[model samples]
Target: MDIEDLHSWPDSVEEAEALQERLRDRVREEPGPAVVRTVAGLDVAYGSHSDEAVAAAVVVLDAATLRVVESAVAVERPSFPYVPGLFAFRELPALLSALRKLRATPDLLVCDGHGRAHFRRFGLACHLGLLTGLPAVGVGKTFLVGEHVEPGRERGSFTDLVHEGEVVGRTLRTQTGVKPVYVSVGHRVDLDTATRHVLALSPSYRLPETTRQSDRLSRAALRERESDPASAPPPAAAPRGR
Candidate 1:
């Protein structure tokens, strides 16, 4: 699997914003294949309060059956610190590993973070989509960018996520009376199509089945790795000056 260097990890908001704009130019936003048969979800977890991060990915059935197909996991050094507007640097390394290990190419990717919903218009989903050249959608739990009004109580309700006088994403209501998921285009898809895909995958829950299952799988795998003595390596010595 190909793993890019984490040396490009940004250390400041200005650097992060520049990187964000550069990344947007790298993504190709267009109408992708509408007949999606395979879908993937991406998620991450931390070890010992963010010193190290673990990433997990799962591919699943996108049709009415909703069955799992394949999955992968990875571990890497946490290069970027825990910053709100620059999460991509912290998680992208491990996530790239997990994605490379996947058995099949996914038709669509549902990321566990924002896309265009960012202060600089580049989030994990958008970055990954650009790096992989795959169609992706972001479903964030909280607001990282944009201003929007509250959606309706019923299912399938939504409003535009506006920022700087432009509609960048959607505040999607996947299930009735539940908190909405922030939907946005990562690459090779539009906001409307992204919202439709999220709803189609959400048969009985607030989150899409692919995303929820992947989240569970990621957490479970991290816990397993922590508990398994054989899988873990010996700890290194602490830094000399510390």
Candidate 2:
């Protein structure tokens, strides 16, 4: 997948916001896949035994069985400062590098963050999907910027996450008698499809397997980097070629 952005790494909040504004319109809210064979999950882990480094992990799974197919991990320094809504800028570089390491082109991208449910309507999932031209969905653990009524305790129940009077995402109950996860359309995907994918992915746990696997992978990568000196970030990542 080719990631297209006029500004790949923005230093300031104004520059990042401007780049996000430029790319936000490219997102498509369409039904992604009626039957998905493979889905990829992405997450980042910070504090890798050093404040300057972070680890990114991408895990691809067989959607039917929810079994891991492939996984990749990349460690890199934070390219941008920590900003609330512009998280993609901080993590996307490493995530993209890790993404390129995958042998499988996933049918859908299940990211551990928000998508359209953001202040700029462009979150990590949206940025990645727009760049890769893939059907991506954001599965956030916590609410970012939205107001929603509490969903039912039963699994599969949901409430509209309204932000600025617009339906940005969904507060979805993926497991019975558990806290709901937030679902949002990333790119080339809709709310209903995103919600359905989330439910399908999370069978027993509060978080989906994609998230769990990737999280574990990232932390492991960080630990490996801590013991090994050869794990430093390269001057150039193949930048994670497809």
Candidate 3:
């Protein structure tokens, strides 16, 4: 897979906000791959310390079989503040590195974050899709900046996630008697298609396999890094801030 670099990585909130405004237009509200063969899940696990570091994991799976086709992990230090909406700057660098290592190009990227359902309308999924030029969608466990009535306790039930008079996403019930997950379009994908793919990927669980597997892989990667003699610090070590 080819990785397109971010135009700029701004560490400050002001600059990052400016960058989001400049790049938000790049997101296309269209359908993704017609014949979905592969999908990749992305997640970043942070260290215990504020400025310690992070490990990004990309796990690609066969859309039909839901089996992993490829997996990669990258570790790197933070580059931006741990702001609510700007964590992308800290994670994107390492996530892109892992994506570049993949032998198979993914048809879609499923992010464990928000997309258009953000205050700036450009969350991690939106930012990642802009940088990689890939079809992406965000499936979040909690509401970011949206309000909606509770969906029915049945699989496939959904309601509009409206924010500031715009339906930015959907609250989808992937499993019966379980909490709903938020779905939003990232890039090169429409809200309907994004919801469909997320449901297809999550046949039995509240969260899709993509997110679950990526979560496990990323956490494992971070733990492995923490145990390495070269990476670990003394017990009396203090947290590092940005």
Candidate 4:
């Protein structure tokens, strides 16, 4: 899977914000693949002992069976500082590296972050979808920049997540009697379609298999990097301006 070099990496928070503003216009909120054969989950894990150290994981699964098809991980230091709305700048590079290592090109991407629901409407999932030219959805554990009425407890129930009086996403209940997840369109996918995909991916667990598996793999990769001296991360860079 090849990622498009859409823009240069931003070095400062101002630059990151500007980039997001420019690229946000390119995100297409339309129907994606009519028949998704495979789906990939993406996540990143940070080392507890070192703020700079992080691991990104991508797990591809057969959509019909929910069986693992391919996976990859990349361990590296964050290239940017931790800014509230500029989180993608810190993780995108590492996640792209991990994505490039995958042998399979997934039909859809499920990111553990917000997309159109973001403050700037360009979260990790949107950035990744634009770069990869793949249909993507963001299934966040918490709300980023939206307000929604509590959805019904039944699985498949959802309500519009509105930000600034615009329908940006959905607060979805993926499991009966479990906490809901936030779902948003990343790229080339509509909110209804994205919500359906998320529910299908999460049959039993509160989170979809794609997120659960990738999260576990990312943590494992970080643990392995931490235990091996040869794989130690470089000296942490000074925090950049916000």
> Highest TM-score among the candidates is held by which one?
4
Residue-level lDDT tens digits of model 3 in 12-129: 6898899898888888998656678999999989888857778889999999999998999987777677888786777777788788889878889999998999889999899888
Clashing pairs in 1: none
lDDT of 3 at 123: 92
Per-residue lDDT of 1-242 in model 2, one digit per residue for the tens? 45564344565899889988888998899875788999999999986343477799999999989999999988888767788998887788789888877776889999999999999999989988977888999999998998999999999999999999999999999888999999999999889999888999999998999999999999988888877877666542223332
Tens-digit per-residue lDDT, 1-242, candidate 1: 33333236566667877878876766666767587888888888777657654545555565557788788877555666678878777777667767878767888889989888777788888887877777889998887877999999999999999999988889888889999988988988988788989899897999888788888887877788778756762232211111
C-alpha positional error of residue 78 in candidate 1 after TM-score superposition, expressed in Å: 1.4
What lDDT does candidate 1 reach at residue 217? 80
TM, every model: 0.87, 0.93, 0.93, 0.95
RMSD of each: 4.6, 2.3, 4.3, 3.1
Evaluate all candidate structures by whole-model CA lDDT and list the values in order. 0.77, 0.86, 0.86, 0.89
- Which residue segments of model 4 deviate by more than 4 Å? 234-242
Error of 2 at 73 (Å): 0.8
Q: How accurate is candidate 2 locally (lDDT)?
A: 0.86
lDDT, model 2, position 78: 74
- Candidate 3 overall lDDT versus native: 0.86
TM-score of 4: 0.95
Query: What are the per-residue Cα lDDT tens digits for candidate 4 across 1-242?
Result: 77776877677788889999999999999976779999999999988843568788999999999999999998878878788878877777778878888877999999999899999999989998999999999999999897999999999999999999999999999999999999999999999899999999999999999999999999999988888888876553322221
